[model samples]
Target: MKQTIEQLADVELTENMLKIAKRELREDKCSREQSLEQMRNWVLKHEDLRNVRLDDQFLLRFLRCKKFSVPMAQQTLLKYLNVRRTFPHMSTQLDFLDQKLNDIISSGYIFASPNRDKHGRRVVVINAKGFNPKIYNSSDQARAHFLTYECLMEDQATQICGLVHVGDFSGVTTTHVTNWNPTEFARVFKWSEQSLPLRHKEIHLVNVPATLKWLIDFVKGRVSSKIRNRLTLYTQDKELAKHVDPACLPQELGGQMPLKAIVELWKAELLAKRETILNLDKIALLSDRGILRKSNYSSEKSSNGMNFVSQIESIEGSFRKLEFD
Candidate 1:
């Protein structure tokens, strides 16, 4: 059983997981090979996405996240690369061994739970207290987050089951809130919502300081209704556990395993995938030649510029009204 779970990324489909994938993601085993071929052909022909990874495992992540819709997967792939191009500081040349990043991981600021939730989603925790603004800037934090997400997405179980993010803001100070550039924050938020191939099942913010409420509201207003609906706020860990099982959480947040132990395990996982993460630097867009195809996806256009905040706010008001009504 353990070996089977370990081999899932090698396209070893489990009957039970296949059923879930079929029901939830429209993934049909009978047609999966055909679908993969179609996605591969489209990517190969895309003039803009140069040097994109073409392996079945890499392509399957986008396909599964888009529910096997080829066109959606294409758009997502483009957006993902575009994000890397736009935010070179955050995404490119991601070195896990860098002392600053290593220290951040060692502090256990952000990590995915080794255990899956009741609904089979991976639980990712972000303890704001672990961060020291004096030592590292927001870009370092973003890099750490990018590295963690890239590593986690390599898992087939994570790709299919999705992720639940828990933001532990217990010790978050006013300085932490002020450190972020609003435009950069909005752009990153937009990319997470639209570009990333991973499914976001839920986002729970716990022990949030009053200082961050405005920022939370800002995020709620900008994200899609699906994300907004999945967003939940908790005043205490007890309340958070009601939604995310305590068994999946680290000991610091009322779980069984020690936080240090979880961080150590996660560090080892990162080390194992060091080459895979480093290879991300090779994926580049053919933007200089102007051969990149423009996406009709709204977020694709919104991902650029200082005007994102105003643009989202203007659109979100009407979007929310239509969604709520």
Candidate 2:
């Protein structure tokens, strides 16, 4: 077993983790030599990507997402980098440090648990109880989400071990539900389905209000079956503990630490990395627009292998039923 960040904030990768990270270089079809060769070739061919640091860990994210298929990994990496270009508002910059954005984040809207689950997946809790639809719109919420996820991705353990989400709906009201933007929600669904590099193992929604049950159906239509199957809804907080470790949860959900303090730590870390994040966005913006070199790769290349396609189709075929549903 490898050690990751604990409750108090210091994170150090153990020798076992280092070994696992190194082993990935040779384990899949995107073997270190093959993948790096292709990535370096792709970068060399495009002037824009030349300056982009093709760090092994960074490249591995795309490779693992694509099951280590060289061509598939290449195409996904390029497309993933172009996310900022497609959605300018989702830029990874100092914008997240804005007062309003900070306010939303400070409210404990979303934060990751320092602890990992049995599978070693990091726990990401979305404190919907802290959400006030009146004060923050979809864009504000989206930025807050982007910041938290982006920062979380920086941790090697999170990228490899994956994530499980806990949506605490304890304080949700009609106002918040009404304010939920279906369009933005759909966009997020599509992004998670097609582009997000991490493996979202599961989603546990706790404290579901009777009135909010319909929201599940609304989401089912928009998200792929894969995600829908991972959805688990609970009417109360205790039911959530059956699925997630109590110690891994925030005090808001009967855990040790207060949610506010957890969010504060995450906010401080984000502020510290402001410059590095902004520079990454600047590079991506340049590459996305072909300012560096036009991505000659075609999107259709992603479909050649049935393994990846079937992985998605399998999700489409299955649907998990919630107790309320």
Best by TM-score: 1
Off by over 4 Å in 1: 1-14, 288-325
User: What's the TM for model 2?
Assistant: 0.76
By summed lDDT, the worst window of 10 consecutive residues in model 1 runs over 316-325
Q: Kindly list the per-residue Cα lDDT of model 1 for residues 125-202, writing each as its tens digit.
A: 999988998789989999999999999888787788889999998877655655566556777877766888989999
Could you give candidate 2's per-residue lDDT for residues 221-321 as a string of tens digits? Answer: 54667888999998877788878877788877877777777777777878876765666665542555542333232221223433432333343323222
Please report, in order, the local distance difference test score of every candidate based on alpha carbons. Answer: 0.78, 0.65
Can you give the TM-score per candidate against the true fold?
A: 0.86, 0.76
Candidate 2's displacement at residue 129, Å, is 2.5
Question: RMSD for each model, in Å, please?
Answer: 6.5, 8.1
Model 1 TM-score, 2 decimals: 0.86
